[model samples]
Target: MTETDPVTAAPSGKGLDARLVVRRGSFRLDVELSAAPGDVVALLGPNGAGKTTALRALAGLTPLSEGGRLWLDGVRLDRTPPESRPVGVVFQDYLLFPHLSALDNIAFGPRCRGVPKAEARTQAAAWLERMGLAEFAGTRPRRLSGGQAQRVAVARALATRPRLLLLDEPLAALDARTRLDVRAQLRHHLADFEAVAVLVTHDPLDAMVLADRLVVVEDGRVVQEGGPSDIARGPRTDYIAQLVGLNLYRGEAEGHTVRLEAGPAITTTERLDGPVFVAFPPGAVTLHRDRPSGSSARNLWQCRVAGLETHGDQIRVDLTGELPLAADLTTVATAELGLRPGSSVWATVKAAQTHAYPA
Candidate 1:
């Protein structure tokens, strides 16, 4: 649906309900979101999809257009200033002050809110202990590791005692090993938080691990939203399909046969009719240099290799022919078949391996 179209959900007993609309030249963004207390929601999409803009609107960093409204705990917040709102934000880069000690950095927010300096430092000490960074409290930002810096940033945000917490790519700067440890730690902290938390991220794994709900936005509109498992198992768009490593097709179904809009037909075990979707993992696809005559697979197509890439231990071959598809094969099989770009191949998939659901 278009962004201007009304999209809503039943409000929970208490939390956040925001309707944001912002116009920049010819571009416009409109979205409605709701979350109950203790709820964590992740806004996930590609770059330039308005995910960050929505977060900025909630944080009061960006002014809303006419007719926009923001509410938290039954109080209006649309016109409130960022510093005045009961909101806390951890930016993408963490944005820790270079010259301030870790302890001072966490204490700054509370101190600015009129808390006594000694009391603020005491609270900062407690937060640092909670984040397992007490040993580094005296160190500056430049001396802390990526994970340590992120924890300090989170502690700083929490010190404000905000009713709404916002995070933008909270773990984007960490290395792979550090990301795992910090992500687990962050999940624990978020669980203990009693307020509503909204995070902006482009990574699906981060969304699934850190948030209770996923809102998939595209081109300034929310295209799909649900629990992580539901979104992964039943992706509605090609972008999601690619994210979850599944090949997807849209088609008109008649009984068990689904005729694809692009071309060819897929035989599925599901007894669906009318408009439908068919999806299968790349691993379920088998590729061969020559088509087998006695194969039991119900779907087979002649395809040419369009591209190839390594996916962990296996090789993923992109193909184009009757159906644009991706097939995952072992390195041994790839070498034996001389697979490469421009190579001709036959791909087959069993009906039992394909899943079909109503669109």
Candidate 2:
């Protein structure tokens, strides 16, 4: 696509714009991405979904396919070498040099880019101060805490003043408590950054919280792209719906009823026509030991309990029968219903609980 094309164009004449294509035997990844300066877009997907491949392509670590292209700040970078490209990468493990002090590690990038040792050290010191890591300047990567090392890695990336910043699971290395604090700090730093940033992650919470926009890649292609709330409320693919904790199905809709392609029809509050997607949260489903004859719910089905697992404080029961779906219930309710695998049960959901949108 041309630079001016609405689908793949960055805002105005600058920022990031590219189509990344990579072929590895039978697997091919073709994904188009665009972002304005100061925008942070997350490449989110499941394992082996090419999120890392896309990030590597952007950093020039992976060669693009014959038809692929890369651009940043209106400058073409298709043939640029990794060391020559104005890109900074923060790897999953942080990749700090164990032998070097934190400050020296941060200075390495600037030093490699032709800056004098003293000047590079000065810049690195400033970055450490900015990232609140000046106190750990003399400490080696082995001595720094996970959160401290992460901030140091980010400082090291920023010390070179790159035009494009790429983070591959930047927060994935920290523990739960550390991740919470570091994620907030990272968000603050990213807000202050003016260059384009692309983050690759499988964590929906990370992508939704840290990114200004989300580009969901699945099976080597862009399945959906939009604001966090938009994608959360209206997921287009089963993967996305599952990521956002919603059960989804594609079907033909006529008025309030949607005839699913693979299962029973669903009744929704929306009166849509043509092909559509029906979605509802697992919590929307109510289960019963036997069918309720006087139920007010318009949608009901006789289902068999396929599986049961604890989801946080509630029990999530997987059902299979006329309609395959999931239901969430409290532990007390689960025991009261005497639910178990192979047990027969009835599931019901109000029409208002289901959402239907055009496919």
Task: List model 2 lDDT by residue over 87-135, tens digit each.
Answer: 9999999999999999999999999999999999999999999888888
* Per-model TM-score on C-alpha atoms: 0.95, 0.95
Report the C-alpha lDDT of model 1 over 1-359, residue by residue, as the tens digit.
45443322323367998888888887777877889989999998888989999999999988998757788887778868888999999998999999999999999999999999999999999999999888998999999999999999999999998899999999999999999999999999999999999999988889999999998888878889999999988899999898888999999999999999988999999988899999999999998899889899999999999999999799999999989999999999999999989999999999999999888
Model 2 segments more than 4 A misplaced? 1-12
Please estimate how well model 2 matches the true structure, expressed as its whole-model Cα lDDT: 0.92
Backbone collisions counted per model: 0, 0
TM-score (C-alpha, index-matched) for candidate 1? 0.95
Task: Tell me the spans in candidate 1 whose CA falls farther than 4 Å from its real position.
Answer: 1-12
Candidate 1 least-lDDT 10 residues: 3-12
